[model samples]
Target: MSYELRDHTADVAVEATADTLAALFAAVAEGLTAASAQSVPATPGDRFEVEVAAESREALLFDYLDRLIYERDVRLVLPADHRCTVAEPSETDRTDESDDPDAWRLAASARGVPLDAVAAREIKAVTYSEMALERRGDGWRAYVVFDV
Candidate 1:
């Protein structure tokens, strides 16, 4: 799994590719963190978990990135070492909101150190503009734009 930062007219974009859905998410998360900091200290630090559910894959990606922003803003940390899993609810797992289209859920864990420890940039927010997520052949790719 890998991700690259691309130039944007007025922000930053990340495009990530992976052999599996979970790895793709993790790659994108790392890209987001990279966009904000020059480098993250490899030392161990506080760990946190994030969980999000959305009605579509794109929405899930948007929400996931937004949540990371919220975590950073509130906790004043730069997160790293991301690991995440994405799941689709089965028929048996459906609730009263069964009318909803196929839902996607993400559960992630990562470690963070104080933001002061890293040379950081300001990413105002994650934007829906030019956002995309899709499966290609046996692999998956995700793209996201962050407002600077």
Candidate 2:
């Protein structure tokens, strides 16, 4: 899993890639954390857990990133690193509840120090502009824009 910051006209953008959905989510979380502050302390001060569900993959990514932003704003903490697990319903796991039976679920844990420990920048929200998540030849890639 890896992430890189891209230049945006009025906000911040991140591109992340990984071999699996869970790793992709974790990489994006790390990207958002890196964009929110100049530096994070080496010590892991606190751990925050997040769980989110959405009907589709795109919605799931949006909600997941939004939750991370909410955690940063409300808790005044910078997520230095994260681990995520995504449960995407497979054919065997699907039921006949709806036409699209594959519901996406994500559970994540983030570790970070207080925002006061470093120079911080406020990320207002995660935006849909230029957002994308797709499969490559061997892995998945995601691009997200943040309202800074």
What TM-score, over all chains together, does every model reach?
A: 0.91, 0.89
Model 2 stretches astray by more than 4 angstroms: 90-101
Taking the tens digit of each residue's C-alpha lDDT, what string does model 2 give over 53-117?
78888899999989987887788888768999988856665546553456787889888678888
Q: What is the lDDT of candidate 1?
A: 0.88
Residue 44 Cα positional deviation in candidate 2, in Å, after optimal superposition: 2.9
Instruction: Write down the lDDT of every candidate, Cα atoms only.
Output: 0.88, 0.87
Q: Highest lDDT, which number?
A: 1
As a whole number from 0 to 100, the lDDT of residue 107 in candidate 1 is 91
What is the TM-score of candidate 1? 0.91
126 Cα displacement, candidate 2 (Å): 0.4
Error at 28, model 2, angstroms: 0.9
